[model samples]
Target: MSYRFVTPIPKRAATGSVAAVYSASARELGALFAPHLSPAPDLHAALWAVLRESMLAGTAPRARKEAVAAAVAVVNRCPFCVDAHAAMLHATGSHDTADAITRGEAPDPLVAWARSTRSAAPDPWPFPAAHVPEYVGTALANHFINRMVDALRPGSLLPGGVLRAPSRRAAGLALARTVRRTITPGESLALLEPGAGPAPAWAGDGPVATAWPAFERAARAGGALLGPTARAAVLEAVAGWRGEHPELGGWPGSVLGAVPEDERPGARLALLAALAPYRLTESAVAAWRSSVGPRGDAELVRVLGFGAFTAVSRLADRVAVVA
Candidate 1:
């Protein structure tokens, strides 16, 4: 559970040559998730790896995924996720689309119903339990969300109404979301924490610091990041940090400042350093950073901070999910 720092080598100039970075990163991540993998030996670890791979593959166009993710985040009352997804949606095209989504505008009748279901409004008519289970509301919301997510696949969403088949990655992320929902915040935190067992060493300070600001900018630009389960894990980490160090209460600014500059390697190594304490290896931390991109790294940190506050809020009997 102690911290150690690792140095980072600048990635090759060729943007296309992401293989080296990705491979190195995946190795480290694999180590971080090792403990969780140990108990189930088959189910948990296998599924986790598969999901991680799917995320890396970018199976669907970023825009579609963002749209659905944003919708789900909104309905779930998770501001962090909403903001993050909205940013992603904006990145793909126009600010107008992002704005409309955040404001709850539906482009068509189907979309309207989708929005309503996402908000958990009652169905227009009653149906048999077999057709609509007790959790019909949640299931409907998820279905609509899945539809949006599925639209991410190439040709799935076209101007004139062409429906392209869904990619494996799109299907995978949806499946991952479902599985992730089954895991409670406490359980995930336990899996991610350092004491669970030996994990990859921390990469360095550069990535951590670099990522913090990036996440902040992304959240400010859009709103939130990470789905419910991942968001909860972030909050749990932040709360744990605060409980041990009361002075670092707020997120981004306060939390970023908590780590001594001298102890930090550099902005490029910040993420590695930040994760080092958690026993992540250099390669693993690097991969996480690479997967997030500079902006993603920053946004993730901000989300994590918000997540921590969320956990605290819940403990105090406040709202469980932030709107």
Candidate 2:
């Protein structure tokens, strides 16, 4: 199969029904990133749960939130996300505004704020102080997921006009519905306590604020599985990276070279898989899968997801601090 996946997709039988809902939505959207997550349902659920709270379960109007999401998608160059978010805007009778955002135009101050953060610019908090939490949190959350999905999806993604027709827009709205219903705001925190991690003060005191703990839990889970040496190497390899730019950032020359040669490729791939998947290659995927065997594949998924969560959320921390 040419390594259709480096890790097993979250199967209904393996991950149970709750994870299956995420699987179904991912399949429906052709979301390349979701298959990689099936191996770690809790992490996957945690990611989406945070996004749902930050973007949806807040005081911001639904259309405005979708517009904010569309703007973030435009900056991340994720057409699939642009479509999904734009359609949500359309469903809320803001199709014109959605159209503008998909083209990279900042329709308003809030959308502009999201774009500024993408370029590592200051988060001026153009919107109300109360809205900053969800807005910026959504920015940070989508930035993480967009990187993973864009890295895995085909170069030329879905066309923009598919939803131009009224009926097609309705279809997109339906897709968004499936994604919304997958997990509750705090469903991922069912077994864990909120407010466990000491996050930055800029974290909005909204539904999404608790995401810090979920992300912390995911990082700890992967850290436990990977051991200290691998964890340190991954962090060192990605030092100084902000996880904003799509390209590799200050990639240290082969951080895993100290390990066994056979293990080096897997270790390095794991680092990029976590920090910058846009640089992932089929050869690398093939090598890592072949070397790791099946068990290593699942472990790698946890490592990458956790790694991305940390890197992406770190950007959020910085934004919160600066703002």
- Specify the highest-TM-score model's number: 2
Give candidate 2 misplaced runs (Cα > 4 Å). 1-35, 151-170, 173-188, 191-196, 204-206, 223-230, 242-263, 293-297
**In order, how many clashes per candidate?**
38, 1
lDDT tens digits by residue: candidate 1, 89-142 = 554553565567667775433224334442323223232222121112222223
Cα deviation in Å at residue 176, candidate 1?
A: 23
Q: Against the true structure, what is each candidate's TM-score?
A: 0.26, 0.75
Candidate 1 stretches greater than 4 Å from native = 1-61, 108-114, 117-323
Q: What is the C-alpha lDDT of each candidate?
A: 0.30, 0.60
Best candidate (score: lDDT): 2
Q: Candidate 2 — which pairs collide?
A: 10-38
For residues 11-116, write the lDDT of model 2, one tens digit per residue.
4455552354455345433243355555666666566656666765667676676777778777766765676677767766677787788677987877887776
